[model samples]
Target: MLAHARQLLDGSVPLPAGTARVAAAMLIRRALEELAAEWSGCPEATTRSQLVIAARRLPPTEAERACLAWFALSEACHHHAYRLPPNPVELVRWLSVVGGLPAPHP
Candidate 1:
């Protein structure tokens, strides 16, 4: 997903910049949502609750940053008539942070 997001933003995917931005945000949001669910041990939890639950197990400082990014990603995923898609810089930042998450324990 991260690779795809980068491709979309970098023009490899051939999407309009704004569309690519939104698409990348959606992909990254899904990845983060899944990670939060796994960390929280509640696959069935709603996206809104997943982060809060996961934060309990995450490091104190990192959790706050993750939550802020998650919210921004969520908003970016939605189409707002009045607002434009998210900036590529924010998506790139999120990709790095999500990429840095520890691999799931077996």
Candidate 2:
């Protein structure tokens, strides 16, 4: 999902800037949610609150970053007439946040 989002932003995929940004944001959100579910040992990341709860378990600074990233990604994923899609920079920042999360141990 993160790779797809990177492709969307990197022009490997043909998408308008606005559309690609939103699509990338959506993909990043999915990746973040899955990471949160795993990190929290929850059955699933079924709600925004679940993600927040997961974020809160991290070290203080990381927890703050995770919460902010989740909020930004969630907002970016929505389609609202008055709102603009996230810019590449913002999406990339969220991607970094998602990437920074720990992967589940085998």
Candidate 3:
């Protein structure tokens, strides 16, 4: 998913607002899913809300926690069809927070 997100962000051409929105959503969603799965061993489907709750349990930095909170409430991509595409820079920051999370134990 991150790879696909990267492809969408390649900037080979100007991305449509809808395309950018989907890309941002996909990247963040995948990141949240992974974090949730790592937090809980269930490994089944999980919602963004659930992921955010799970994230709070981890020993995350304040910025990471805030980023997760933003992901939980931000509607940047939720209404892509109705609203403007999210800022690429902000999306990248969210992705960075995800990337910064500690790896799961072996």
Candidate 4:
């Protein structure tokens, strides 16, 4: 699911507005589903929170930034309790995926 999300993010598959967020929500939902199936009992609140955060951090293309910013802001308003992921590796990957980083990994 994450791989599919990545593909969509990378433009391998075109996604319309709300598609990325929906995809991410579905992936996290499935993870929670698997945990519930095993009686592992995932924290729905925390997972939902993180997925929201990830969706917000998604980069917008230059042409789409204005529209995406509005969408992102609306999503933020509803999910105000969510916290962004803090792990360094995850942060780096998120920035890279969002096109906030330089090319070729120099």
Candidate 5:
């Protein structure tokens, strides 16, 4: 998902900015899902909304929390807007911080 977001933003896929925002939002949500399962131990979360609420129960860093908040808003409304598309570079940085979380111990 992160790679696809990068590809879309890098012009390899030639998609619109809003499309890239959707992909970026998805990547962030993917990170949240991982956090909800691994950090929060709520593997039953099946939807982004559930993951979002579950993530709040964990102790994410300030940056991670901010990224999650941005992701929620983007996923909820950015895809339908014509302006204020998310910046790919910022999205990449956010993914690097949030999506690059380490695996949990066995």
Candidate 6:
């Protein structure tokens, strides 16, 4: 599974970004499912929290940064048009770093 994750990071799979996101989500979901089965008494919330943290650690590449910027702007516009709360600007900054738009500050 780790190998598969690494492959995904390598960007050699030639899939669309949305497709890749779905695949990545599925992989994480499966791991959570397995972990839940293995640790019968563990809270699902804990497992989900840990998964989110781990997923956040998977830094994006330069190409991904462009995608994220476009995605964020599109989402913001959509929400604004509908009178929904705007997405956090922190998300844009975080995605910028993760997508390799810029190096994270020390």
Positional deviation of residue 82's Cα in model 2 after best superposition, in angstroms: 1.4
| Residue 5 lDDT (model 4) | 42
- The order of the candidates by lDDT, greatest first, is 1, 2, 3, 5, 6, 4
Scored by Cα lDDT, where does model 5 land? 0.58
For model 4, name the residue pairs that clash.
none
- The sequence of per-residue lDDT tens digits that candidate 3 reaches over residues 12-83 is 536885676566666776665666676655576455555565556666574356445356425665664566
Which regions of candidate 5 fall more than 4 Å away from where they truly are? 45-83
> lDDT of all the models against the reference?
0.82, 0.81, 0.60, 0.38, 0.58, 0.40
Q: Looking at candidate 6, what is the lDDT of residue 83?
A: 51
Per-residue CA lDDT of candidate 4, range 37-66, in tens? 222233454433433433344343522332
Worst 10 residues of 2 by lDDT: 43-52
Top-scoring candidate (TM-score): 1
Cα lDDT of model 5 by residue, 1-106, tens digit: 6676567657787667777666666767565555546544557755454445544654556435644655654554445545666666666666666546554445
- Backbone clashes per model, in order? 0, 0, 0, 0, 0, 0
Error of 4 at 53 (Å): 25
Candidate 6, residues 26-86, lDDT tens digits: the string is 4433433343333333345554443344334434444344334434434433323435433
lDDT, candidate 1, 1-106, per-residue tens: 8888889989999878888889999888888877887887888988768778877878876677678878889888887799988987888998888877754444
Give the per-residue Cα lDDT of candidate 3 at 93.
64
Which candidate model has the greater TM-score, 3 or 6? 3
The C-alpha local distance difference test score for the whole of candidate 6 amounts to: 0.40
Give the candidates in order of TM-score, highest first: 1, 2, 3, 5, 6, 4
lDDT of each residue in 1-106, candidate 2, tens digit only: 9999999989999998899899999999888777777667775546566666766677778767767888888888888999888988998888988888767544
Cα deviation of 16 in candidate 2 (Å)?
A: 1.6
